[model samples]
Target chain A: MNPSMAITEAPGLFTANGLTGLIFLVMMAVTLIGGLIACTAERLVRSVAGLIVCFIGVAALYYFLNSPFVALMQILIYVGAVCITIAFAIMLAAPEENKKNGPAGPLSGPLAFITAGIVTIGLIVMAMRAKFTSLPKVNGGSVKEIGIQFLTSYSMVFELISIVLLIAIIGALVIARAGRSK
Target chain B: MSFLTLYNNLNTFLYLAAILFGMGVYGIVTHRTLIGMLISSELILAAASINFMAFNRFTAPDPTVGQVFTLFIMAIAAAEAAIGLSIIIAVYRNYKSVDTEDLVELNG
Candidate 1:
């Protein structure tokens, strides 16, 4: 009876579990591949494309992390706004003729690889060694909860950010305009 | 762990953040152009935000704090990009080139 019961339940559980696993694997692959291209691509335009792809994968990761509000904001702010602004900057400043200049020096490539690798290994080791204590969740961390918190608990911060953004816009306009006259 | 179970663990996110940070570092150290450095800096900031969000999800009592902090990061990054790009434009206008090798005027 027990053997027959196990045999019957195994296939049902496998199909139910396998589909979600496959999706997660795909997303992870997207994230890593995007990161690789963003960092290693020779052309600046390809790097920017990689950055967009990576940001999208990150947004998906945020969704998996149980923050749909953050995931949406990630897409809206990082992918939609930031990437476009960067594209504009690239179009305005970088010329194709300069892209032919190869890497800075013979040692630069190896040195940078060593430095980044060391830092990554160190951080991973620290993360593995640290025994973190989980705290109790206070709220559901939903969009409504985040909205309330922004207005009530974090209202001052929200307002300050608005002011900062305003200042940044004015400053950018002033600086960019200054170059136009020359 | 199994394939679909990647998100169920904290270490997975931590490792991902580490790799992202490494990539950012590599970009910053390389790349002759200022705009490329700016992009790399954004990558570093994103890596930091990811770490904060992961800890907030897995450990913190008040998850709102991390969300708020990440929001602040986005605001700051936006400001940084604006200011940096403007500076790049000004630099390009003055120097006629954005390559780091050519911008050295104060070097004695």
Candidate 2:
């Protein structure tokens, strides 16, 4: 019944399960490292790369959370679409030659870091202290169930989102195109 | 609390989300460029989604709700990104710069 023992008894250090776990760990590392780079890198392009890495990590995390559908969507949307779009923006708008000067005010950079650190610590402490009672599962959150819930319970919101997306697309095209003539 | 069961703990995900949120805040506050700020905003939204999914996995009665909600959030985020980037492009064309410091034409 002990799967860990069975896993360890396999010849190589990388059994199927162990290899999966290792890959997960590596992905986690990539995610965190990417986030750090995205937040701290001086260059915008490097930050975009970090964002891609972090997103891939998030997708992996989604898979670990038992939502492969969302995970794939995350990769497709965030990495495939968003990051590439951002890269194009970086190229078009952001000047590559300008070195990042320190923040505007004298205390801006340090103050921002301190503020972020404090907020992170406070939230982590609160989360750790809170009492969370586990609830019984009504139904397994399968892909079929997700589809049914999307249509039934969240149909209004789903429809609204489609409309919002449509508006966004038209608005983006309008705004971006408005400048080309001038 | 145990190291071996880190993935099973709700708090781990919460702390991760918290970190992501804080990083997003820092980026938003400090980034000079509009596009960078938008990217940071996306990070904040992703952090919120993580928190939702964590609660969904650990405590929600109907877990599909959270997943669906997260999906909606993703959709909104995608649209937001598209719009935001286009706005950035438009602004760059008008002002010739994306730096927040230089966007002072409305100072009057």
Candidate 3:
């Protein structure tokens, strides 16, 4: 994110590097705790809250990754649009009074925990073992560069995604409206 | 090398994404309600995006490409969430319940 390549000197506790490290740790904790709550909570509303928390942590992580634009999008599209829509759906469809069914068997409980554990372990091991070759960046991935590329080489895909989004909106309206007459 | 500096390593982000993806998989399989599954699916998508951004930050020859692709992914995910939630709303209207077990009328 900075014009400087890397920090040469060791960071003291309250210096910029040290403070950044602290923030990174906090974001990691937020992400993990939020993820745990999102998956494990029994209430849908609580789970959605957890999702929002998790997305915020992720957006912060994006900022750390040096892409503020994506971070902003993460907040805008996800926390703003998607989660709110889901919350509204919850209000309209599944209310608090409904008899909350527990997760179905065979896939729920200990089996699901084991499955998830195994998968997580496998992936973590793979990540730990793999060697990443860092290639030099050709250009700084700035927001303006992102915009120019979007309008140029990626224009076709961008237009296609927009069209898909349009269709999805119309289709959602029709589908949600169809059952109203009954 | 240090725990505080974990953010600088590519492996750290990779591990984070993997854990999130695993959580999503567990959620999709175990959640009894349609909305829970949809939420889990979003988690999966987020994990994928993180992986892309990590690779973009660390290794890509052209850094802008990953960010560009991630933007498109966000658009697609927004569309999917919109359509999926509407379908859930319609399904709830039809059945009066959104539980996965209650949607077995057409299973024959």
Best by lDDT: 3
TM-scores of the first chain across all predictions? 0.88, 0.85, 0.91
**lDDT ranking, high to low:** 3, 2, 1
CA lDDT for candidate 2: 0.81
lDDT per residue as tens, model 1, A31-60: 778877777778778888888898888888
What 10-residue stretch in candidate 3 chain A is worst by lDDT? A1-10
Candidate 1's docking class is medium
- Tens digits of per-residue lDDT for model 1, B87-106: 89888888887888888998
Residue B79 displacement (Å), model 2: 0.9
Models 1 onward score TM values of 0.92, 0.90, 0.95
Candidate 1, residue A163: Cα displacement in angstroms equals 0.9
Instruction: Evaluate residue A94 in candidate 2 and report its C-alpha lDDT on the 0 to 100 scale.
Output: 87
| Range of the 10 consecutive residues with the lowest summed lDDT in candidate 1 chain B | B1-10
**lDDT of residue B83 for candidate 2:** 93
Give the alpha carbon lDDT tens digit for every residue of A72-160 in model 2.
88889889988899999999998877647236577888999999999999998888777877777899899999999989988998899
lDDT over C-alpha atoms for residue A116 of model 3: 87
- TM-score (C-alpha) between model 2 and the true structure: 0.90
After TM-score superposition, the amount by which residue B55's alpha carbon in candidate 3 deviates from its true location, in angstroms, is: 0.4
